[model samples]
Target chain A: MRLLEALALTITNGSKPVCRNQNFHLQAGEIWGVLGPNGIGKTSLLHTLAGLRKPLSGQITLMDKPLASYDRKQLATQLGIVFQDSQDTFPSTVLETVLMGRHPYLSEWAWESVEDISLCMTALEQVALATLAQRQVNTLSGGERRRLALAILLVQNPSICLLDEPTNHLDLHHQMVLLELIVQKTLRNNGGVVMVLQDVNLVPRFCTHVLLMHNADSWISGPVADVMTTTNLQLLYQHSIRKLVDNGVTLFYPE
Target chain B: MPVFSPAVPVLSGRYFLVLFFVALFAALSFVVALGLGSADISFNDIVAVLTGTSDSLNQQIILQIRLPRVQTGMCVGGMLAMAGCLMQILLRNPLAEPYVLGVSGGAAVFALLAIVSGLSGLWINGSAFAGALLSIFLVFVLSRIGNDWNPLRILLTGVVISAGWSAFISFLLAVSPPDQLHGMLFWLMGDLSYVQSSFWNPIVLAVVLLPSLVYARSMNLLATGDLNAAALGVNVTRLQYFIYFASSLLTATAVMQGGSIGFIGLVVPHLVRILFGSDHRILLPVSVMLGGSLLVIADGLARSLIAPEQLPVGVLTAMLGVPLFLVLLQTILFRQRT
Candidate 1:
C-alpha cells in the first residue's frame, strides 16, 4: 500500500563520497535487512531515510512525492525511527517518555488526554513493560531500555519503521524479544521494517529481504532465499560460513 | 517504592535549604544595618521610627531613605540572582551566569557611553539595558556560527566582548575629570548605594524569563543531549534560539538597573544546584528569593561594618559570597567524583 524509494542516492561528508548511485525501495508488508561491515554507512543510510540526516545528493520519495515534502512531525506519524545511542538528560518516567509520541498532535501546553495515556500504555503492554511504566528511564536495564525505546516508537504509530540496530545492546533473549516485537508491529500494520544488522543468519529468519555492504562496496540484495547463500555470505563477509540443521531450523554461523 | 511527592518534589526540598539560609542571613543584615551610621541611631529607635510616622528628619531617615534603600537592595539582589538562574538553565550549562557572561559588561559599556555623552538619570538605565541586550545578542550570534550552536561560542564571545568593553570604559576613565573618575570605577565594579525604588520596572520586565524557562518542563529532556531531544521531537533549533534571546533580555534588564551586583548569579545557582539539583522549576524561584536576601545582607554589611565609612556593597557581596561559593563548588565536585 506504501512505497519508500531512495532515488540515485549519494551521501558524502566533504572529502570523498561515502555512498554513490544507490537505490532501494520498500513496499509495505515485509521487513528488509541491511547487512554491512563497520564503515559501510548502514547507520548513515538509515539516518538519511528517516529524515534525521541531510544527504549530499539525491532525493527520497514516499507515495510518489519527494521525501522532503513530508513535514518531519507528520512523517513521524507514518515512520518511526530508533536511534543507536541512549541520551543522558531525560529523567521522565517510562510512561511520560512513551507519551512523548503524542507530541505532534498536542499543543505546547495541553495535558496528555486519556486517549494519549491509553495509547502510550498500549505500547508498553505490547513490549511487556506495562509494569515498568512508573520507573525512571535511567533506571531501566539495558534490555528493558531497548524495549522501552521500541515502545516509544510504537506509540508514534508509524506505518514504516527504521531501526539502526534493533539488537545492538541486547543479550540473546532480549535480542529475540526485540526482533519478535518488530516483526509483530510490521505484520499488524502491514508495514515494512528496514533494519541494519551484522549477524547474517538473522536475515533469513525474520527478514524478508537482505542488502549487504562490504569494503565500501554495495553487494547482493534480494529475497532471502536468493541472496542468503553460503557463497554470498562468505564473499560479502570475506569469511567462511557453516550451515547446520538443528531440530527444524537452518542456522548459519561463521566457522 | 520511594513515592516522590509530586508537590514538595525532591528539587524543592533541596532548594528550600539554600533559600532559607540566605533569607535568614538577609534578615539579620537588615536589623544590624539599621543600628549604625555617623549619627548613631538605637536599633529600638529605628524600629519605632519605622512603625510610627514622626515628622522629624530622624524619622524620615528610617522611612524614606534607609528603608527604601534596604528594600531596593532586597529587590535588585533577588532580580540579579533570578536572572542568573534563568540564564544558566536556558543555556543548559552550570557555569552560565549573568555578570560574567558579558550581559552586564555589554550593558555597562552602553550605559557608560550614555552617561558621559551627557545622558543622566533614567536615560542611563535605558542605555544600559540596550547595551546589555546588544552584547548578549552579539555573543549569541557568534556562538551559533555555522549553526553548530555550541556553549563554547557564547563563553568565548562573552570574554571577547568583556575585554573590548573594559578597554572602552578605561579609555573614558582616562579622559574624565578626576572627581568623576572614582564614580565611574565604582559603577563599573558594581555598587548598590544608588538604590532607587523606580528600579522595579526592570524587575517586572524580567518576569517573562521565568515562564519561558518554566514552560520547558521539557528542558530536563535537553540534559539528555540535542540528538536525543531531536529524536523525541523537541523543536531543538527553536528552543535554543528562544532561550538565548530570553536569557539575554533578562540579564540585560538586571545589569541596566543594578550597576553590577556580583557573585549572586554565579554562586547562587551553583549552590542551588548542589543542594537541589538541575530542575529549572525549583532552581528559578529559589535563586530569585535567595538572591534578594543575599544582597540585603551584603548591602547591610557594606553600610554598617565601619562606624561611619561606607564600603561599596559589591565589595561586601564578593567578600561573603566568594568563600561560600568556593566551598559549595568543592563539595559538589568532590561528592560527584566518588
Candidate 2:
C-alpha cells in the first residue's frame, strides 16, 4: 500500500526553493533514507512533508488523500515526525513528555487512560528510558533526550514516520539499536519510514531505498544497491568517494 | 520483558486530596476574614449572619461591610492567579504575570486620570476597565501586525506598551494636586477599600474558569513551543488567541475590582507548582483556590494591621508572598539536593 506520495514537490526555505519538482512514492515496509550535504534543506523537506510548513509548489498525499485536507489532529493520527532537536521551555516529567503522543487520540478534557500509559511505558522501555520516566526532561543528557523523542514517536504509532536525523546525538551502540528498532517496528506494522540520515554507511544497511538530494532541482533515488554507488555519493557530496566490500557487506567512504 | 508501572499518577487521588485541602483552606480563610474586623464578631455570630439567623448590628457589619470586601478579594485574587498561570503558558515564560502584558498599567493610567478629574465610585473602575480593554486591543493588534502571533513578539509588544503607560502614569501623578494624591496613590497600590459586592465578580469567574479548564490540557502541550504543539495536534493559533483574550479579560476584571493586586498572580501559581507538579489539569484550579485564600487572609490582615487604617492589599501580598515563596523554594531545592 502507498503510505505517502509527493508529486512534483518543491520544498523551500522561506524564499528560495531548496529542492524542486521532486516525485516519490513511499510504500509499506520501505525505509527511505534522505542523504544530503550540510545546509541542503533536508530538514525543510522533512518539515514540508509533515505538513508543518507549506511546500513551495506541488502536492503531498497521505493515505491517498490530499495532505492539506487533513486537520492537525487527523494528520497526526496518520503521520508522525521526530524533529532534529526539541526545546525544553517548561518543566515536565519524561513520562509526561512521551505521553504527549496520545494527545491527538484524546478528546478535549480527557486524561490519558491505562492503555495509553502502557503504550508510553513500552516505548520508553524500547528506548532504554523506562527507568527515567519520572525524571524531569530538562535534566536529561543530549542522547537521552534524543531517545525520548524517538519514544514519543513510537507511542504516537502513526503509519508514516518522518524522522529528521534520528541518529543524531546517539552513541555507536544506541545508534544501531534505535535504527533497527524503528525498521523492525515499521515492518511489523506495515508502515513506511523516511529518515534524514548523516551517516552514509547506515543507509545501505538499514534502508531498502535512498533519496539522494544532490542540489536544488537535481536528485536521484532508487533501491540502495542501485543509487548508493561511489559515483552517485561523490556527486551528491561534491567530493571524491571510494567503495569497498567486507564480508559481503558494501561500504562507501570519502577518498 | 519487565513489568512497568506509572511513574506519576496523571490525575490520581493524591491530586484530588491536595485540591480538597486547598479548598478547605479557602473556606476557612473566608470564615476567618468574615469574623476578624474592627468590631470583633464571634465565630458563632459570623456563622449566624451567614446562615441568615442573626439580626443584630453585628449581622449588619458582617453582611454589609466584611462580606462584600472578602468576596471581592477572593474573586479578584482568583482571577489574577488564573490569569498569571495562563500568561506563563501563553508566553511560555516562567516570569509572565497578568500585568506583564500592560493591562494593569493601562488601567492604572486611566484610573489615575479619573481620580485627578474628581471622579469617585464606579467612575474610576469603569474608566480603568475601559483602559484595560484598550490596552488588550492595542497589544492584540500590534503583536499581530504580520499575522505572526509568536510569544516573543507578543511579550515584547506588551512590555513596550507597559512602559508607555508607566510614563503617562508618572506624568499624571506629577500634575495631580496634593489633596487627590492620597486616593491616587492608594488606587495605584491596589486598594480594595471601596469595592462593593457585585454578582459580576462570581459570574466573570465562572465564565472564564469553565473554558480555561476545558483548554487546560492543550495548555500543557503548548508550553513546549508553538511548532511542537502544532505537531502534537493542537491548533496553535487558535489556542494562542484564546489564551490572549481569556487572560486579558481576567486581568481587566481583576484590575477593575482591586486596582491590579500584585504578587498573587505572579507568585500564587509558582506556589502551587512547587507544591504540586506542573500538570495544568491540577495547576489551574489549585492556583485559583490558593490565590483566593491567600488574598482573603491578606485583606484581613490589611484591615486589622492598623485597626481602621487599611493598607492596600497589594502591599500585604508582596510582604507576605516574597518570604513565603523564597522559603518554599529553598526548602524544595534543599530536599531535591538531599
Candidate 3:
C-alpha cells in the first residue's frame, strides 16, 4: 500500500546520518534480512519502520496511505515487533510474559480468553518452549530467554514482523530453531518478516532477500545471492574476507 | 503419573476473591473497631443501636463519632496503600513510596495551603488534588528538558522538591499566627480525630480508583517496566500519562482524609508482593484489605495505649511499619538469592 511505503526515509543524530533516505518495498510472505556491521543504522532503520522512533524527513505509506495516519493501537495489531535484547530480567513466568503479547487483542476489563490461552500455547510450541512455559525468564539461560522472546512475537501474530538482532546471545541450536520457525510461519501465511541479524551465515539459510547496511548511509539490498559476496562483505566490514566454500558461510576479519 | 487434564485450568475466581472472606474480614474489623474503648458496648447493644432500639448517650457516641471515624480510617488506609502501590508500579521503582516522587508532598503543600488559607477541610481535597497534578506536570516538564526524560533523574528531582515543600511547611508553623498553629500542626501530624458522618467523599474516590486499577490490568503490566511492556504492543506513552493522573488522584484523595499515613502504602504492597507473588491481580486488592486492618489496629493502639493524649497515627505507622518492611525484604531477598 502507498501508506506503508517509505520514500527517502532518513534519520540522524546531529551531523551523522543513521539511515540515509532509503526506499524499500515490504510485501507479505517474504522474509527480509537486514545485515550490517556494528554502529551501522540497521537498528535505527528497524526502529523508524516500527514507529518506535520518528524519521527526520521523508514519508512512510501503508495500505496506500501515510503510515502516521494509523494510531498506535491500529498499527500494533498489524505490526508485531521483537526487539533486540530479549533479556527479560524480571521474575515473571514464561506464560505471563507470553500472554502479554495478547495485550493488543484484549480489552482493559477482559481476562485472557480461551482462544488467547491456546494461541499462547501454540506459539510456545512453535518455538519448542511448550514444556518451559511455567519457568521464570530470570531463571532461564541466555539461549532459552531468546527463544521465549521469539515465542512472544509469534503469539502476537501481526502481519509484519520486525525483529532487531533476534539471533544475538543464542546458541547455534536456538538460532536455527528461531529462524526456521519464522520462515515456516511467515512463508506459509504469506506474512512479512523484516529482521536485523548479525551472522551473515544464517542470512543465506533462512532469508529470501537481504539488505546490507554499511556505515550509516549505504545499503545494497536484493537477493541473498547478490548481497552476500566477498567484495560487499569486505567493504561493509572494512576487512579482509576469508571464504569457507563447503560450509556455505563467509567470515570477515579486520586486517 | 495420571495425566493432567488438557482442559483449561480452573483457578479460584471472584467467589474467593470478590465479596468473600476478604470483604468479610474487613467488615468484621470495622465492627470490632467501633465497639472497642472506654464505652465498650456488647455486640447486642451495637446491634440495638443500628436497629434503633437503643438511644442512650453511649449508643449516640458509638453511632455518631466512633463508627464514622473507624470506618473512614479503614477507607483512608486502603486508599493510601493502594495509591502507593500503583505509584510504585507506575514509576517502576521498588523504593517508591507515596510521597517519594513528590506527588504526595505536593498535595501536602496544597492541603496545607488550603488549611492555612481558612478553607474548609473538603476544599483541602480539591486543592490537594490540583497541587498533585501541578507538581506532576512540573516534574514531567523538568525531566523532559533538553533530552528524553530519564526516570532516575526524575526520582532525584522529586526527592528535592518533597524536601523543599516539607521545610516550607515547618516554616509555616514556626512563623504562623498563634491561633492557626494548632490546626496546621494537627494536619501535618496526620490526625484521624476529624472523622464525621459527612466525610464520605474520600471513600467514593477510593471505591472508584480501586475498581479502575483492578479493571485495567494491562496498565499494571506496562507499569511493571516500560520496554518489556512496549515490545508486547502496549501504548506506553498513553499508559504513562493515565497512570500519572490516576496515581496522583489516588494519593491526593488519600492524603485528604488519612493525613499522611506513612508506611501503609510502602509496607502493605510489599507484603502482598511477597505473599502471592508480584502479579497485581493479587497485589492491589490484598494491599487494600491488609492495609485497612493494619491501620485500624494501629489507630486502636494509638488511641487506647495512652488514652486521653493522642499520638498522631502517622508516627505509629512509621515506627511499626518500617521494621516489618525491613524484615520482609530481607527474607524475600534471601530466598531469591539462595
Candidate 4:
C-alpha cells in the first residue's frame, strides 16, 4: 500500500525557496533515509512529508487521500512523527506521558482502559523504560528522553512513522537496538518509515532506499545499493572517500 | 503451581486519598468561615440554622451576610485558578496567568467607567464582561498578524495591550470625582463583600469548568509543546481557540464577581501541580477545590483581621500568594542550576 507520495513538491522559507521540484513515493514495507549536509533543507523536507509543513507547489497524499483533506484526528491515527527533542515544562510521570499516545483512539473524557495501559507498558518495556515509568520526565537524561519519544510512537501504533534524527543522542548499544526496533515494528505492520539521519554507515546498513539532498533544486534518490556508492557518496558530501567491502556489507568513509 | 506472585502494578492509591483530603479541607474551611465574624456565631449556632432549629440574629448574619459571600468567594477563586491553568497550558509558560493577557486590565477599565458613571449592579458587570471580551478579541487579532498562533507573539501582544489598558485606567482614575474614589478603590482591590446574589457566578463557573474538564487530556498533550500535540493528532489551533475563549470568559466572570482578584489564578495551579501530578485531569479539579478553599480562608482573615472594618480580598490573596510564589520561583531556579 502507498503510505505517502509527493509530486512536484517545492518548499520555501519565507520568500526564498529552499527545495524545488521534488518527487517521491513511500510504500509499505520500505525503510527510507533522508540525508543531506547541514542547512540543506533536510529537516524542511522531512517536516513537509510529515504534514507539519505545507509544500510551496505540489500535492501530498497520505493513505490514498489528500493530506490536507484529513482532519487532525484522522491524520494522527495513520501518521506519527517523532521529533528530535521534546520539552518537559510540566512534571508528568513517564507512564502518563506514554499513555498520551492512546488519545487519538479514545473519546474525550474517557480514561485509559486496561488494554491501553498494557500497550503502554509493553512499549515502555520494549524501550527498557518500564522501571522508570513512575519517574518524572523532567528527571530523564537526553538518551532516555529520546527512548521515551520512541516509546510514545510505539504506543501510538501509527501505520506510517516519520522520525528526525532518531539516533542523535544515544550510546552504541541503544542506537542499534532502537534502529532494529523501528525497522522490526514497521515491517511487522507493513508500513513505511522515513528517517532523517546524519550517520553515513547507518544508511547502508538499514535503509532500503536513500534520498540524498545536495542543495536547493537538487537531489538523488534510489535503492540503497544503487544510490549509496562510494563515488556517489563522495560527490554528495563533497569529500574524498575510502570504500571497503567486507563480505556482502559495504562501508564508506572519508579518507 | 509451586508459587503464585501477584504483580504489583505501578498504579498508586494516593490519588483518591489525596483528593478526599482536599475535599475534606474545603468542607472544613467552609464550615469554619461561617462562624468567623464579629457577631460571634458559634459552630452550634451554624448547625442549628442548618437544621432549622434556630431563628436568632446570628442565623440572619450567617445566612444573609456570610453564606452568599463565601459562595461567591469559592466561585470566583475557582474560576480564576481554572482560567490560570488554561492560560499556562495554552502558552506553555509556567508564569502565564489569567491577567497576563490583559483580561483583568480590560475589565478594570470598563468596570471603572461604569462605576464613575454611577451605573449600578448588573450594568457594571455587563460592561466589565464586554470590555474583557473586547480585550480578548483585540489580543487574538493582533497576535495573528503574519504567522500562526505563536505563543510568544500572543504573549507579547497581551503584555503591550495590558500596558495600554493600565494607562487608560490611570486616565479614568485621574478624571473621576473624589467622592467615588473610595468605591473605585474598593472595587479595583477586589471585595467579595459586595457580592449580592450567587446565581450567575456558580452558573458561569459550571458552564466553563465542565467543558474544560472534557479537554483535560488534550491540555496534557499541549503542555509538552505544539509540535508534540499536533503530531499526536490534537487539533492544536482549535484547542488554542477553546482555551483562549474559555479562559477569557472565566476571567471576565471572576472580575465581575470580585474586581480582579489576583494571585489565586497564578498560584493555585502551581500549588496543585506541586502536590498532585501535572495531569490536567487531576490538576484542574484539585486546583479548583484548593483555590476555592484558599480564597474562603483569605476572605475570613480579611474580614476578621480588623473586625468592624474590611479589607479587599485581593490584598490578602497577594499577601499570602506572593511569598508562596517567591518560594516556587526559588525552587525552580534551584532545580535549573543543578
Tell me, by TM-score, which candidate is best.
Answer: 2
| Model 1 residue B96 distance off true place after TM-score fit, in angstroms | 2.5
DockQ values of all predictions: 0.22, 0.57, 0.33, 0.54
iRMSD of all candidate structures? 5.3, 3.7, 4.5, 5.5
Better of 3 and 4 by lDDT: 4
Query: Clashing pairs in model 4?
Result: none
Instruction: Give the proportion of true interface contacts each model preserves, from 0 to 1.
Output: 0.19, 0.64, 0.22, 0.67
Which regions in candidate 4 have their CA more than 4 angstroms from the true location? B1-20, B174-179, B322-338
Q: Write the per-residue lDDT of candidate 2 for residues A1-255, one digit (tens) a residue.
A: 999998999887867678888898899989999999998899998888888888878999998999989999888888999999998766678998898989999988788888888999999999999998888788899999999999988988888899999999999999999999988988899999999999999998999999999888888998998999988998899999998999988888887
Q: What is the TM-score of chain A in candidate 3?
A: 0.90
Q: Rank by TM-score, highest first.
A: 2, 4, 3, 1
Give per-model CA RMSD: 5.7, 2.7, 4.2, 4.1
- What is the Å distance of residue A233 in model 4 from its true position? 2.6
DockQ leader: 2
Total clashes, candidate 3?
11
Show model 2 residue runs off by greater than 4 Å: B1-7
Q: Under CAPRI classification, how is model 1 graded?
A: incorrect
Error of 4 at B285 (Å): 1.8
Tens-digit per-residue lDDT, B250-278, candidate 3: 67666766667778888887776665545
- For model 2 the local lDDT of residue B210 reads 90
TM-score of every candidate: 0.75, 0.96, 0.87, 0.93
